[model samples]
Target: NDWHTAIIPNWLKTIYAEDPFFQKTATVYTIHNLAYQGIFGWRILEIAGIDEYGFLYPEIAELANVVDLMARGILFADVITTVSERYAQEILTPEYGEKLDPILRDRKDRLFGILNGIDTEELNPATDPYLAANFDVSSLDRRVENKLDLQRKANMPPNPDVPLLGMISRLTDQKGFDLVGQVIDPLLRLFDVQFVLLGTGDPHYHAMFRRVAEEYPDKTGIFLTFNAELAQKIYGGSDMFLMPSRFEPCGLGQMIAMRYGSVPVVRETGGLADTVKDFDPRTGEGNGFTFKQYDPWAFFGAIIRAVETWKHRDVWRKLQIRGMTQDFSWDRSARKYIEVYFKALEFRAAETVGGSRP
Candidate 1:
């Protein structure tokens, strides 16, 4: 799906170029994250046996002396796709392109963005074994028991009225920890909410959150280790799920959060933009709270909106039910993927009939 298997397209286009069976095969290259392209020195191309092709895009200066496997995949694949519709568009711009915008733009017509889906059976709140109490949209009242269980596990007093915000991600700038660091102190000071964080990453954030936990022991629950059971508890317990990422390709967290009845509060970019619509009080239409700009205040503003919305119990329950009831299953996404596969096959058929590679 990413750089690790990107070279398969290169091998198909070059090493197996003349083979009748391989010629009929169409490759669909999917980019999960563009930032981690498998780039190496030019000499390594000989080892891959594609040295005869030299560089895929020598016109692009940065790629002149390197073998970028991901670029090769993009150049050779019949169809290119990313995780979400928004990310497919974002990667065409310089801001989010990760130096591959030119090639991506050239192949824009072949590019497709399909929003990812979660495993409904495994993540279903009604069936999750990890949660203290299993509850669906209909039995949402029973969900509070899980909050109390999570509070006890995190060593905090169980308060049903206080909103509990949950975050499960690596502690890094990409995940929007920088914005969190900036607004967390004020958020804790200004609001009567409890924040629970799970997952570990950058040492700086680890140290930062450790201090946050130390300073606000009563209001913060920090676990710097990965625990699958604890993760399910956080999803089932928290009232709001936070995912203010700098750029998310396609976030499964927000979908999983919604499935578990945790309303998402996320930055409007990539999959987060496509999935989590901003909550509107008047119409009550959205599944979550979202901010567009990457500024700390913008993120804080979205959080405040969620916090305010939580005050209205009936409206909040409706929002939760709206999110929980919506489908984010593989059935829809699998159909889209089948379409992409057919489109890829069409491209290959056209090339074969025309006697020219597209």
Candidate 2:
């Protein structure tokens, strides 16, 4: 049901509000993605036999026709949170808020952003069961074995000299797939690099990538769907990962790629802006490359920078190892969630004279 789809575990609001037993337990709602928040009109309320004849004047309730459920969740919950510190800020902006700006403004003091973490043991390239070879941050030379295996499986020409650019994401406007699909031919013509795209998305984007693979069989490979094992292989094998989202709340793929020695070349937006630091040649402090502009050329420019740095084999190897060594674990995120739960409990305690929990 669209209602339920819009409201995952949102029913707790009414339940916890009414039942003191449930209220004793605090709830910390994590907003992984906000764009798909549950939204509907007066009809839904009316269908449920809830009267809409009153309290419809506020600008937000006026759109009772389409109130983002997440927006309402923010106002209703004792505390709210998102995936990254930068994304936590981005959500307050009108452009990114998607009509939830006013509500977010009201609850600004209560919202906390926690950066997500990955399971190192499950994702390590050396221990991963999916990869063709086992290698660590130090023995990265062995990564090429997995790369060759990937190239052979995909029918791409085996060329260790050429950089392999990888992308594994749902093909969508949000992912900036529109730009990649439109400009892939030009990019292939311009560089000797190989692009390997894996994921299913809009039919047009899928067709476009298939066309690209057909046009340049040796340089372009498209897998139109994702498999967990295959994703691990690409992460451990590919030389570079590409993420050009229009707005990403927080991305897990780029982090995983770095853990597997794949340097990321991403657009600076949302969590991408927060996680991937633009590479610096002199200091060599940053992990990967980034571009601020959304234009196709800006994306190309970032790729060019990555290519220029790749020429320095030792430096590039160091960059990969540095990225693979980063930590983004769920435990850190879980602790932050626990903190929000405590805040919620405090709010619930304050509202109830009996001091019931939230």
Candidate 3:
């Protein structure tokens, strides 16, 4: 399948150029992650049926003695889109583009970012079949019962008053496990909080969390593995969800957490910035907690604020309700997708008539 990557794009280009019927159709390419661009050696050109001279084309040659499938797709496709609006802009910058910044900047006008939506119904805490107790914004008492059940399951003592934080993510440097590993034990010692972490990645984090669990058995529950049902339970049961990602293109965890009435504590970068807003004490407006910097102090400060907000039962309840009411379903995102499709068609029509890209 990986070998097909060398052949498919060129084959498609041949089909579009030779077949009038196919030429009339519009092509749209999406960049889900700019970091993984399928960069292979120059030999791939032979597999793509391109001679040495053909590989010397400006578009192919610019990717540095190697061939990049993603770059070729961008050069050939009618329109290019990313998963999030912020990420779309981010990719045009040298910091996040992974050496495709110039290509992305040149095609900025054709680049679109459509924030991906979640399955609200599937993530709804009230209707999630996996939860031990299902409840909605109206029945938060039952929601607390689920928390107690989760605590018992994690063997972290059933105490509904203490703030319980949950995380279901890959424990890697990109996910900010570097900072998390440093601050967790200290945070647990200082606050009356419990954490349920579920994930499996990077032996360093696995050992780090295991050490933390051994030190603070009652306060931390670390599951170094993946379990979908357990993930849903954490979403439904926890008071807050944590995602301190260094750079998130578009995070599904924050959206899903809000859907389940769990406030998100995330670092402000990419989609996390777009979705999670800092709490305004003057107006009490934001849904979740967010920190601007990637520093450990900033992350911990956001947690402190969230824990402080948790102390005020009335304020915490209102914040929970506000989060639960947020709507990030597929309907809006699908409409944007359709709009991009039409734009791609228009670009294709323009290119066909003029025999060049706009």
Candidate 4:
């Protein structure tokens, strides 16, 4: 779905260009993340046996002497898509394009965006064996047992009144760890909240979070290793799920957390923006808490709002129920993909009849 399989489009357009069966074959390239483009030295083109075609876009100076497989996939594929609609639009700009904006803009007409969906059957909280207690929207009161269980496992005090925030992500600046590092100390000191973090990443973040754990032993839980069971526990147990990504292609974590009855607190960017609507207290609508700017104070402000909202027990329960009931299944995303596939075939048909690339 990303850089690894990106070269297939190049090979199909080059090696199989004249093959009768391949001539009618249309390729659809899906970009899960744009940051990790499969870039290599120009000599790699000879190894790929597409040296005759050389660099596809020599006019773009940055790609003129390099073999960028992702670019080739975008350029040669009949259709291109990203994991989320917002990311597809974001990648067309220089900020999130990873130096591929020119090429992506060139193929913008053929590009589409379809959000990735979680398997609802597998992620169902009601059927999850990993959770300490199983509950759905109808029986959300039963969800508190999971929070107590998670607290005991993390060696923290089991207080149902304290708001527990859970995070399962790669500890990196891109995931908004920089923002977390900036505001976590004040957040812990000023608020009556608890934080539980899972997943492993950069050594810098590991040391930083370790300091947090040591400083706020009573309120913080840090698990530096990945455990699928623990991940589910965090999802089902935590009062709020944190995903402050600077840019997310299509984050499944927020969706899964909501499915598990954990209200999401996310940064408004990419898929996070598409899926998480800012909660309006006046209207009593929307799914989660969101902040737009990629600033520490902005993130801290959102967390404060979530904590304040938690004070009103009835309001909090309604928020959790609202998040839990939303449909994030693959059915909707599957239909969009089917539309993109048909669009790819139409492009292929047009190319064949017109004897020109679409």
Candidate 5:
């Protein structure tokens, strides 16, 4: 149950209390994002047909004069989960909790974070129709054709030697466009890298990226619109993907890029930290490049390392293979959800037997 639909879960729970068959059933409420809790005026409580059930506790339903739907869901539901394990923990802090930290802290034991996975079949690079070339992990050499095609399509110089960097994200501060905006021009001036960005959000970023593309037409390719086909092409064609998010709940772009053999150069925050690892040249064990600091130089440093590693064909290929072989599919995550269900059931059973008072 999310805030927008929190009433549905509460209504179901009310009905469950009456029916003996479902009396002991546990209600699970999932918090996809805690920032957008549906806190409305007290009138909503009456509209939701729950005014009769007065919220006596301030923590349960009331946040000042408003009725916090998210709070009610958290209070009534037997279990709560966030999108990623790190994000679940992050929301318990004052910085990320959006004024709900105390309420979440109370239910820390019941809260869970099961990392979200992708539909591997739908995102497969081997069978994608939008790419100029179709290739699998073993046939990575054919990926160059796609790179060349993307170069031509973007009207950039068709130089396969120069590393191509791809970004498919919303142009927002949280997505780390602020850091990119700061260092992109300087990085372009120095490096022999070609950049292609596809996204649309925040008018200022649209103007900013478009200006950059105009200034460096030969090396920079920017499309200030969301195109799914172009996004797939970028995933397939690019040598490296970029996601320097300030804080990401859980990212699917990095996983998609890996599936297409594009190594991600990302900031170590939230799921980005959990997924992408720093590549060690000596060991050649990690999948992609990662940096801990949110600073622009840190992001640029990761990019530089990726480009340097790209110079060594054997090492670069190994990195791509490692990323591609990663199991980012839903099977593992689904099992974790099963475990959550059982844990919730166990908690409900214990509470029922003990006659625990809320």
Candidate 6:
């Protein structure tokens, strides 16, 4: 139905509109992105025949916008969460607040931010079928085999000497697809790097990358559709992952890349900032290279830094090995959510005289 997109806001309104069900059951709403909040009109709600005193008002109906719905959801939801703790706080600010600052502040105590986890078993470099040679956590030799295989598979010349910079994401303005397009020609010419990208998003980006690929056939490969297996191969075979998100709530690709033993070269924003620590060669402490500035040059400069490190085979190998070993699993994250759930339950029970855990 056309109203399915409006279901969330409608349901939230319905739950609290002199109804006993919301009072009966505890709900914790997870706001993954405030920007794309599902906004539908009161007309749809009226068509659905769900008019109530609180929900029938004109202002209430117009609150169907994404940001307002988030605020409304925060008001009614027993608890809420975002992907990371930093983002949880970021959403409460005026700059990063997304116009829900006051609402988020009102519900601050009940809100939680747990870093999302990736399915590591599926992403393990050792057992991935997409790679040419599937090895385990212990053997890094098979990694090289997969790398060479990916080169042959993508039809790019097997130049192990060149840094294979791979990216898999929705080619969008916020994703720094604009930045990539801005500096792509210069970056390709300047660095000994081969670009392999697999994604589909903005049509202009798809066309742009395709044109770039046609112009620099030997240097770039663009796959416009998202293939799960191809993404795995890209992660397994590529030397580094590229993500220069302008404002990321939390990203799964960088985590997936780390699991595949691919170092991330990303802009320091949102989850990328939290996950990919800046590389300090002397200490060898960070997982990948990161830059804070959002400009294309800053992103490309980080790539050059990665390339420099890649030239030193031993150092680069250590970075890849450490990334593969880093745990980005769902287990820890699930536990945190479980804690949040129980906390919500406790609060819910406290609000009801007869309510108690079964």
lDDT of each: 0.92, 0.78, 0.83, 0.89, 0.86, 0.77
Error of 2 at 256 (Å): 0.7
Please provide, for model 4 over 1-358, each residue's C-alpha lDDT reduced to its tens digit, 9 standing for 90 to 100: 7878777777877787777878788889999889988888887777877765343565234355677777777877899999989999999999999988988898899989888899999999999999989999888999999999999988899999999999999998899999999999999998889999998999999999999999999898999999999999999999999999999999999999999999999999999999899899999988889999999999999999999998899998998888888889999999999999999999988887787743
Cα lDDT of candidate 2 equals 0.78
Query: Residue by residue across 1-358, what tens digits does model 3's lDDT show?
Result: 1222324435445544667766667766877777777877877767666665333446434544677777777766777887788888988888887878887788889898888899987788888888988888888878888788889878998998899999999998989999897779779999899999999999989999989999999998889999998899899899999999988988999999888888999998778877788888789999889987789989999998999989998888888888888878999999999999999889878877877742
Per-prediction TM-score to the true structure, in the order listed: 0.97, 0.90, 0.94, 0.97, 0.94, 0.88
Worst 10 residues of 3 by lDDT: 1-10
Top candidate on lDDT is 1
Put the candidates in TM-score order, highest first.
1, 4, 5, 3, 2, 6
- Clash count, one per candidate: 0, 8, 0, 0, 0, 1
lDDT of 1: 0.92
Candidate 2 lDDT, 125-235, residue by residue in tens: 888999999999778889999899888877898878899999999999999987786667777898888888889989988788878888999997789987887788889
For every candidate, C-alpha RMSD to the true structure in Å: 1.3, 3.1, 2.3, 1.4, 1.9, 3.9
Task: Name the regions of candidate 2 deviating beyond 4 angstroms.
Answer: 1-19, 22-25, 46-53, 57-59, 64-68, 353-358
Report the C-alpha lDDT of model 5 over 72-163, residue by residue, as the tens digit: 78776788888888888888898888788888899899899888899999999899999998999889999999999999879999989999
Residue 45 C-alpha lDDT in model 6: 45
Off by over 4 Å in 3: 1-15, 51-54, 57-65
Clashing pairs in 2: 25-358, 26-358, 40-65, 41-65, 117-328, 117-329, 118-328, 118-329
Error of 4 at 164 (Å): 0.6
- Least well predicted 10-residue stretch by lDDT in candidate 2: 1-10
